[model samples]
Target chain A: MSNLPNVPFLKFIYKPKNELEKGGRTEIPAPRQSSEPERRCPNCYKSVPLSKISANMSMCGCGYHFRMTARQRISLICDTFEELWPGVVSNDPLGFPGYVKKLDTVKVASGELEAVVCGKAEIDSQPCCVFIMESYFMMGSMGSAVGEKITRLFEYATMNRLPVVGFTVSGGARMQEGLLSLMQMAKTSGAVRRHSEAGLFYLTVLTDPTMGGVTASFAMEGDIIIAEPGAMVGFAGPRVIEQTTGKTLPKGFQLAESLLEHGFVDAIIPRPEQKEKIGKLLMMNKAVN
Target chain B: MANPKYKSAYEIVKTARSGQRPTGIDMINGCFTDFIELHGDRYFSDDRAIIGGLALLYDIPVTVIAIEKGHTLKERTEHGFGAPQPEGYRKALRLMRQAEKFKRPIICFVDTSGAYCGIDAEERGQGSAIAANLYEMIGLKVPIISVFIGEGGSGGALALAVADKVWMLENAVYSVISPEGCASIIWKDIKKAETAAEYLKMTAYDALELGVADEIISENGLGGDEFYTMLKDKLKAAADELTAFDGLADARYKRFRKFGSYDEITIETEEHK
Candidate 1:
């Protein structure tokens, strides 16, 4: 309706901040130190610590039991357990050279088939398709497979009346595939569009590393975007920013807290409290049914 | 990110370029032809995110696709925050195709985080436009060259950068994903971006090593005239070099033909249930 200038009003703050980076999370290192908080119920006051918490069962603390990894997050929210159908597993549609081997290797090591797992699932007993990015899978860097799965997932989510919940954890697009990998940003974002047109809610949970392609598209497209506490989200990283610009980023530059300060992240939830938070959000949207 | 030890990204590129910020439109001060600025995807409206048309650098004819970051706040809104919507890419494709039809060489200046991630852009088919670019650029029968003059990011940058000769300023980065995205995915903490950047290998040097980028131009300074001078000369040389191929159009087309691919073998079953 109005004439605009010819400039990219926005530039990729290449290394925009995400959460996990700034939460003072000192790595316990492999063979995690005893000082670390073990698997205790995230919500309950019981101090058993997390080490003993069942991976599938809800935390005794907050009565919220759900899968934790990026892959699990998707299945838990998007798929029906008995009929969870994952879309195209990590396949190198790009043939970007050595990308196949890299995918295989990453798959073998991470135990997740691909960077993203998408398919039919039930939320609050409502059958809806879901797309979860396995952070474990190549750090959830979107290759053609990830993109295709997500694109299809959105298509399916909109086709069905079920609200779309994307438990996203990604490093961005897959670099091994080069240009093809970069193209996923459009493919996946396109799916987000059709899904949004139906007026069905699309909930984007910005897990760790939800930057680059993931953030640039669906993560930003969510009707409501919820981030986990201390999660990292941004386009570029601190070291690269440091190396490129020769500046030390602020103490909490890429942290979720920092993003909240910048009006980037809507809210930050701890892992243990995620299920309840998700359940509540789903219920609020349930009135649409 | 105001670390004192190193020059800013703008400074680094300016320094490397011999002290000129190679921003869109600004570099023309030294010497450049004022090409007609085309607008819109011919759909809803022309996006200011992309500025394309016939231009001359040092009297040599060229088709230029400059990512407009918008000069003013109002301009940014019209262009979808300077992130090209599908229309921008469509317009770019139109211009690129035009250049190919006339056998004119194309020069693209990329500096966007990604395609427009806004509501309207999607409704109008941003994805399709980007996809069309991917499909077309690879098979374009013209000598196409792209430079990450500022920030080469996501699908928006890739749409124009599917070129025979891709270049990045010393400080420019061409990455499959951003470090923040990577850190968030791997560590669930955006703070781990520094560690992730190293792992993702998202730098000009990395792209060069991977054969994704053809060359890395070392700018002479952080910001001044020398950089622009070098840029024009180098760009001119690249144009000349591409022109010398004789079968440059065919070569460019073949280069793109080798681009899109899926697996040749069947996928195996996985155990990560």
Candidate 2:
């Protein structure tokens, strides 16, 4: 009913009525067109058959990496994950209109109660606390729930003397929660500091499109920060920058390689090698700690 | 004519937002002597938006870091309108670390609309840079005093503001988001920025009441000889107080930990009613 035009694709994806009526417990049906055998890479505009991309963890041949859900990322990286604080859910602190409903839709679609999943896991026998941001859940924006989960994870790691590993993919702070969402930056950063003060290792693996408040906080506070090849990692998105500066950005402006050149990223590891590389890093950190 | 003594939140916002207001450079020059400018984030190109250096505050050694807004339009654009990119923050961190290593107290001048929100800024990890500063600053083993000189907006402001003692000039404003941004988000109208400014409680006085700022330095009608002298005296006193503390890192950690401390009470419905 609003004057703004409805996005057809989003409407199809977020059919809230059907999703909420089911109490967000079951998987919503994928869009009708997605039933086809091929899945297009949104980044490179290349279409690869579902089977091929699935085998490669949805990475395209042209080197564009599709986003992975937190569960998917954890499954790929950790040998075994015992999820922590699964009951921590979001409340609309600001009482923003329709926020709860939107959260329900995302919850059902992503099978995630919150944007991030934290757990104790082993990477090639190196035990560490892992937190994976679920990009599928509201673009992995940090709200109070996400902040609480991450803070608790850090505290848990500090108490147990375990290293902390974070996989970050976010669009920034959740707008629905307003200032409460912004406060997460400080809270998470404080937690990271405490973890660091304890002489525990903290590593962050930035994936495709990690931006906003998450980038500013725990994502960047890592003792060692690694990124996926060609991931967009920065504070502001390109479109916002283009609009603000009123100029076309240079090609590959926020790419992981560009960040590496800028000294923001330590290394760019491909998905195929991420598990091995992380395991090795954890092993090294264990020796140091 | 606008009343200088008792201005509304909107008036204060306008005055603080004015380009005529004194910038970080002005404060550094007024309060400190023998400044040696430092540059570069060492990771990438040096961001001119933030400038730092070793300086003397009344013959006492210190490091000065400031968000610089240029006087002219050309200068402003070049300086990114005082909004720091990731490199600017990294540069600040680099300098802060240097100051810590050399056992110099740090005096930071905040004057910016916010961090740069451009694609290139984000691509380079603007958030991470700001966050890293916050994470590192809380435990830095040196005295840090941050003064909000003009507009201090959003996490960009907070990034540089995690100090042992945070002071603000009388007319300065600090908030999680700019008034215009808050207005747009809250009311879906940018024109309601004045209302947003009032409700955001971003004035120096408001900050003092909220315990976010330690003191408010009254700059009677912008910067003058009197205002500068008072500011210098205050800075010296704060630095001296901080240096006297034995466990500075622990105190700094506790200072940031207590920020935004509050209590919540839930009302229960009466059974009889």
Candidate 3:
């Protein structure tokens, strides 16, 4: 190891690009009054009007699913939702360079102080604690704030003796927070264990791109685990696996369908039937506790 | 002031990754007696990346588990460079549960870049396996301690590290992500890994300050008999103290519960402030 003097460690923490704020996704420009905007499905390669897709719960005509915001998820699944801990936010405890600015940028872009939105909600009159992760917010990265909110949500549910319904999507532990972010995995798992030991139910719905630290924690700890169709759920990202193993990936590798076949996911629930299915499951579990 | 021996955090990262450093098997062989090797997750094949079994810590019976990266090239390949598959984690948990049943303390040595990233491993539910370990290990009802002997990488290292006391060697580095990966993802340049390492604060000293690690063991006589004896003594002391305690599971939960750093902002709290 070369002993170099004055390594500019601070400079290495670069300010995140604008694209990263939207979880590395390019937004579709608003359509002109003359014609409605259409989004081309990545899987099927067919263009459909944004309104049509929205009416179908963000699924394309060809069965391709698009990521939804946390609020959109809540509106679709919850009949009545009273949010909890809306004011909780991150403290940038590590003081990592560019973290505060990145958080500020992501906050404005996603309209969320953190990646997860926690609340008490009712689905078909079945009450449960719910947390929906915001894919638009730094890719639903699990940092101190995200972890704390989820832990508190579980603790609250435990105290109230209510079941939990969680929607998970994440790149992994937030690198900006470093090891503190890694610790969140253990912390959240501990809380999840306590909640389960209290005989409370946990239903986890893994959304698209649920990988890394989040997958290795509460996302897979659910008593009954399900996934959205085409959701990529795995501990390692596909690219990382391919790079490390030097092997060509099979079609549909790490997809929700693959996980279902492998017995990790109980079912692949589409957006339209998700509410009815989840409500029924919750109601069925209601008799157990 | 920064430590004079390590001018940069990246230097510590390199040292921690060095092949010449003592591996997990070496520590197990040198520190304990009557080591009987255990294998297999029962639900699946045994993973070579993690080795665990019953061992005697001085005169006390204990269960020891370690992620072994091996010393030589062939051995490293056999151990998959210490990156455990889901089965390895399951095997470790099996041993942990067995230890609890037998009323023996549990000890783990972790040194891994991360968990195995392959199609077979993923097919076997790597994420669920690790998640199960974290959730189950918390309420094991036994004295558990984990020591980071080398690189502690993300969730993989964390699976076995949810213990009453988490110790790290002076040179060990633990982070949410490897510096190289962070550099490539954040900076779009792998060569800036040194800078990323510096900013990550992954060294043992950083872990101590961040409250991630409970203590750091000096590597003054690393790989030597004296070093093994000292580590054994420390392990015995921790085990004795932990075994005598009540409510072990609750104490372990509290140990991890205090990790995160964030402030809750609400109207009443803001007014009080």
Task: For candidate 3, write residues B136-243 as lDDT tens digits.
Answer: 999999999999999999999999999999999999989899999999998999999988997888999899999889999999999998999899999999999999
**TM-score values for chain B across all models:** 0.81, 0.92, 0.96
Predicted structure with the largest lDDT when compared to the true one: 3
What is the C-alpha local distance difference test score of candidate 3? 0.91
Tell me model 2's lDDT, rounded to 2 decimals: 0.81
Of models 2 and 3, which has the larger TM-score? 3
Q: Give the distance in Å from residue A264's predicted Cα in candidate 1 to where it truly belongs.
A: 1.2
**Consecutive 10-residue window with the lowest summed lDDT within model 1 chain B:** B11-20
Quick one: ranking by TM-score, best first? Answer: 3, 2, 1
Candidate closest to the true structure, highest TM-score: 3
- Candidate 3 lDDT tens digits, A144-232: 88998999999999999999999999998999999999999999999999999898899999999899899999999999999999999
Native interface contacts kept by each candidate, as a fraction: 0.10, 0.38, 0.75
How far out, in Å, is residue B144 in model 1?
17
Off by over 4 Å in 2: A1-39, A43-64, A87-111, A175-183, A261-263, B1-12, B33-47, B72-80, B85-87, B117-128, B181-211, B216-221, B258-273
Docking class of 1: incorrect
Against the hidden reference, what TM-scores do the models get?
A: 0.51, 0.78, 0.92
**What are the C-alpha RMSDs, in order, of all predicted structures?**
19.0, 11.5, 14.5
